[model samples]
Target: MRKLVVLLLLFGTIAHSQTQGFAKSSDGTPIFYRTFGSGKPILIINGGPGMNSNGFEALAKKLGEHNLTIIYDQRATGKSKLEKPSEKNISMDLMVDDIEQLRQKLGFDSWIVLGHSFGGMLASYYTSLHPEKVEKLILSSSGGIDLELLNHRDLVQKNLDKTYRDSLAYWDKKIRKGDTTYVTKLGRARALAPAYVVNPKFYAMLAKRLSQSDRALNTLVWLDMNRMHFDCSEKLKTFTKPVLILQGKRDIIPAELAERAHKVLQNSRVVLMENCSHYGWLDAENVYFSEIGNFLKP
Candidate 1:
């Protein structure tokens, strides 16, 4: 009976370690985060600059089997709560500072960082600010800091079908007109779905998740964040650490951007997944996992 009680206590301890919690940033913003598995620590950042960590839950769990995977929602997104959210409070610098503070709060000296889409941009910028703190960097389907150079609007529109494009344009105009409601955001997600996935069903699943999360689509954050002070290409070139750039051929972010990023970085490798969209992990899990596994291997 005593042995059974001891075993239960042990299991409870393990479960508690995997539980979700909030790391308070310097400015008192509560950033929600979770830890999984154990071994080499890896910090995974989600995109949207406003997206919660839920979208990457599957991938994080898979990677967690070997590494200590940590995922967090940025300020004003997901479970993270922010008071009086505004452009001044959520700039790129503050976001990077939040990451640093979170690391300190969690008592991790350094960790591997994997940023997906817009999260990739954040990871890159964060590494630039504190390169010594990041052991390695992974950028998934993320373009450079300057959105204009990537031609996201033109490339995404060109690939999408006419129906999707028209719908996206209409919703975008609505969103710009102060209609950033949940329904309007879901409409935008549905319209942009084609650019992110080859399978319409996957898009449906993503749309459902988007609606469930109820993430507020803030255009100002997207605009001001992308207009960063630093040049990602030039800054990344200075880093001596290794970088892995994962890109999907069919993604809204053009493959050329990843290729260009690879060319600029000193120790970087580019993996262009054929027949995969922005959500490469969903489209080609085997290839994605294999590449990540190989890179993460000691």
Candidate 2:
């Protein structure tokens, strides 16, 4: 019995948060989550609000070597359930609550929250609601909810590439002329959006998966996030947790916004991935991992 007990303890301590699917959200959405390693918990909030739990595969592996890394498919994305589109019921606040619920369910009292793009905005709101729960904050290719920065992003997109520039011009002309289904025909590959891909191999894999996706959740969530345009600059200043802000200089999001956000944070550091695009994880994986590891280190 003593030997068996010791063996069980060792397994429990060494085992990663065994990747599992569980029913946590009260609304009946089955959130899928995965984890590896065992240390300070790091929760990764994926972009798109509708993006799946897959993009973080590379990131998880790197971080999982030391820290307990947790990534979940948000309520309406991936394998999570979605509700009928409505006005008041589906709000960002609810999404925040879901994160809190997931954390509580996972037996974590506190966690390092990571948000990328829309996820970053979500994290800002999250830190506001539960400042005490966040051990640290990491924002990647994102900033506080500033719609103006998106306009700045538009200008930056103009100088990206000759082909890309012309395509945007054409798309803009069509959209301005009342072409509602513009992106549907042009596809994501033609827009300023596609320039964000840093790795062709990864891009190809995503493209294949995207083509096979049964739902338009990712695209819809992106539009919803833009339309929501969550403004929490006031709340951003209230975050007491140490923050690490990351942005790509060549990104449409613009690294300057990250600098501005860094100023508002209580204790924050900005990491500009030079000449990289929005997909800094793949664009500058080594730098990103090193920086993240440094920030989380004891």
Best by lDDT: 1
Q: Residue 88 of candidate 2: its Cα lDDT?
A: 42
Residue pairs with backbone atoms closer than 3 Å in model 2 (clashes) = none
lDDT of each: 0.80, 0.72
Question: lDDT by residue for model 2 over 215-243, one digit each (tens)?
Answer: 34545544555677756677778777789
Q: Candidate 1: deviation at residue 95, Å?
A: 0.3
Candidate 1, clashing residue pairs?
Answer: none
**What TM-score do all the candidates reach, one by one?**
0.87, 0.80
lDDT of 2: 0.72
Models, CA RMSD each: 3.3, 5.0
Candidate 1 runs further than 4 Å off: 1-17, 145-150, 169-181, 210-217, 226-228
With candidate 2 superimposed using the best TM-score fit, by how many Å does residue 199's alpha carbon deviate from the native? Answer: 4.7
